[model samples]
Target: MDKNKRILSFLISFFMVISFIVPINAEKDEKNIFKEILKDDFEKNSSIQEIDSAEQKIYMVGVEGESILELLDQGYDEEKANKIALDIQNKAIESIKSFKNVKIGEKYLYTTNGFSITTDRNTAKKISLLPLISSISEAQVYEKRVNNVRNILEIASIKKEYGLDGAGMVVAVLDSGVDHTHKDMNIDSDNVKLTEEIVNGLKSKNKITYGKYFSSKIPFAYNYADDSSNVVRDTLKERADFSHGTHVAGIIGANTKDGGVTGIAPNAQILNMKIFSNNPKVPGASEDKIVKAIDDAVKLGADL
Candidate 1:
């Protein structure tokens, strides 16, 4: 296959691998919870930390918690910088008690400036602004909103009135990876077979594209002083949150399949920009990778 075709094939196979995940318990309930709490925060909804974006679990990446990279920037050695990041991650954990789901990857993917957290957004936000965390955006959705809203602005209504189903639209999902075979996604190609026929079928769909924008892996290390492309590529042998990207893709343009859930824009095209990999049991996606995904999306002619 040519370069474009080769890239697309990898994406198709990637989607096939993740889309087949068997939903664990509470999957349905978690979606309801996400819609209730995250319907308002568009950023959170799009973030890797979003509910069900990673097998219905919370996933976070941090640089502020340990401040390792920051310390190195200030002239600290690798050992000292790692020690500092771990220290901050630990202290912050104790100071902000009651924040559950916090974990620091031994390899060091974190949430705050010192380390990463996996707690609810409200608590994370509260702690993030304390000068310890570099940014408050890393928090999770804390309290579940009592009120539930769907398409509150009536965008769906407007789209319907204008007879728009996002046909010819290009939407990007910057997450783990997507399962293209989900019944509700309206995707007809399940290129999981990896045969030439399956590959060509995936290419024909044209609705889902991959590797055209961002690469399967980023070439830089978290420290930026050295290249860890080999390490990253090796880690990527196992990707994380595969279902999350697929879920987001389905939400954007999933067509109705066998009476399954239909997407808001059934005809819109979807792009798979996998930015994270499996780490710390659940696998992880980092912030810098996300920024790169956004750049790739914009360059790929995505309609915003």
Candidate 2:
């Protein structure tokens, strides 16, 4: 029994040794392969600064105009321009051979096939090369209109007391499309519970509770004439179709958090109605669609 136990322990120890040795050899082999590959391709030049690296590519910044001027000064006429270009290109290629990640730009003119150079400084500096230029940080939001609407305090006060802010209300605007991605107008913001729905044809009904748009005058007149030939109501909806709808919508529904523009009711969901002269010259909504939309808004429980 003692001898059998000894043999069993020996076998277990042997297997353990084999397992450890196998993994070590495998890791060593991989390291050697990587080193060999890197040695064959890597080049270092003082003028070429490496900015970023990836497994398959490396981004580099090289002295601009170096190759072009050198070739010209060396008396390589147009006949040798292609050769000179090739040579300079080869130099850049050699520099990046060992780099795991590299991106070249168009101006390099001498990148390997499939490699292109990018000139943006933010991109270049990220990889460790000297920046192409000084960095400037500008506020991305629309500053002019943002500064004009500083009465958010009053708006907030109104919101707290009435719960009347924009809850259960639908404000429609007709204008250039809202920048839905703006910080102020982003769906997650607190000032408004905004929803968007496109009003395409008169027959199609939107699923959302409230919506509106800026439409043209010609369609409104046509629909009115078809129904009763009564020009009066056609003209009223026509008046609403004008740019006034857009301006009113901006005041009533534009998201203020976007830091560009603020609306009187920043929380109202805007419905964009496009009934106008498709050609910007004429502004009006189709009377048929306008009536339908107003009826739809009523069904959606629109406060405005």
| Best lDDT among the predictions, by candidate number | 1
Q: Rate the local accuracy (lDDT) of all candidates.
A: 0.43, 0.34
Residue-level error in angstroms, candidate 1, position 181: 2.2
How high is each candidate's TM-score? Answer: 0.36, 0.28
Top candidate (TM-score): 1
lDDT of 2 at 253: 47
- RMSD in Å for all candidates: 16.5, 29.1
Residue 108 in candidate 2 has what lDDT? 32
What lDDT does model 2 reach? 0.34
Q: Which 10-residue window in model 2 sums to the lowest lDDT?
A: 137-146
lDDT per residue as tens, model 1, 64-141:
454444667779886776567677766655665545544442223222243334545444444544444443333122
Q: How many clashing residue pairs appear in each of the predictions shown?
A: 24, 38
Q: Give stretches of model 2 more than 4 Å off.
A: 1-164, 174-184, 187-246, 258-261, 280-283
